[model samples]
Target: MARLLALLGSINIGGNRVKMADLKAAFADEGFGDVQTVAASGNAILSDDREPVFIETQLERILADRFGFKSCVMVRTRDEVARAVADNPFHGEGPQHGSDKMVHSIFLSQQPQQSAFDDLLELHKSKGSERLALGTRVLYLDYVYRVGVSDLSNKFLERKLGVKGTARNMNSLKNILSKMDAE
Candidate 1:
């Protein structure tokens, strides 16, 4: 069985709450084993023999039906997550003016168009101190100063990319990978 990481959107925020137990149950009902939630923000790891895209679509449907709400799910394999961590452009760079938690990876449900990527780059250029890098389907952000407040916020990313996604801080991503390994 292949290990998969599911990045679920529109959950556990803004009054839309689903317990980790219920989330795990949903995956288990779908025939996934070793199902676990990395954090309260809809990050889950599971092992399955199906394709990642199929898993994502099925999970989205299951979540919508089960919770009476729509969720955009993005599924990635173990190696994919590893590669994303390895390819972080800010890894070797010196510490930012703020905490490491300021670094974030926005996992996109689908790869954004080149034009969208260009648009984001343009926005980054206008906003000094904030850096942006594009990965396989992830966008890395290094916010030097504004950790909680910035124009390059999660909503800004979704609007700029024209795709559904979930943002995880660098620390959160590392923890998710560690949990995946333990399972």
Candidate 2:
């Protein structure tokens, strides 16, 4: 079975409160092995034989039926997770600087067109210190400030790029990667 990472949005926040134990239980009951949540951040690392797309769909259904809210669950292979970290423009270890806590890896539900990506960049050119970079099925963001108060938000990105996404900061991602590796 391939170990997959499911980045879920709005868990323990936005009124979609869900205990990690409950969430893990739901996934485990659905036959997902090694069902583990990464630091209560709505990130689930599990072993499953289903295809990534199928796993994403199944996770969405499980969340809705069992947890009572809809979420865009980005299920990626372990390699994809590594690529996301390696390819990120703001890993805080490179010239493209950003706070590890402020830098985010946004897992896109669908690939955004180059035109849309361009448009987004153009629109937000003067937004703030937040930097942006496009990745394979991912959008990297260096918030450069508090995300809650930033003009660049998930909703804004979704509208501009025409795809839903979920984000995890650089630190969280590294921790998630470490756990995935150990498994």
TM-score for each predicted model, relative to the true structure: 0.90, 0.95
Please give the distance, in angstroms, between residue 142's alpha carbon in candidate 2 and its true position after superposition.
0.5
- Pick by TM-score: which candidate is best? 2
Q: For model 1, how does the per-residue alpha-carbon lDDT over 48-84 read when each residue is reduced to its tens digit?
A: 9998889988998888888878888889888888777
lDDT of 1 at 75: 92
lDDT, model 1? 0.82
Worst 10 residues of 2 by lDDT: 90-99
The local lDDT score (0 to 100) that residue 142 gets in candidate 2 is 83
- Consecutive 10-residue window with the lowest summed lDDT within model 1: 91-100
* Candidate 2 per-residue C-alpha lDDT over 1-183 given as tens digits, one digit per residue, 9 for 90 to 100: 889899998777778988899999999998999999988779999999888889889999999999789988899988999988889977874334545888889999989999999998898898777789999899998887678888888988999999999998888989999999998
Off by over 4 Å in 1: 92-99
**What Cα-based lDDT does every candidate model obtain?**
0.82, 0.89
Deviation in Å, model 2, residue 137 alpha carbon: 0.4
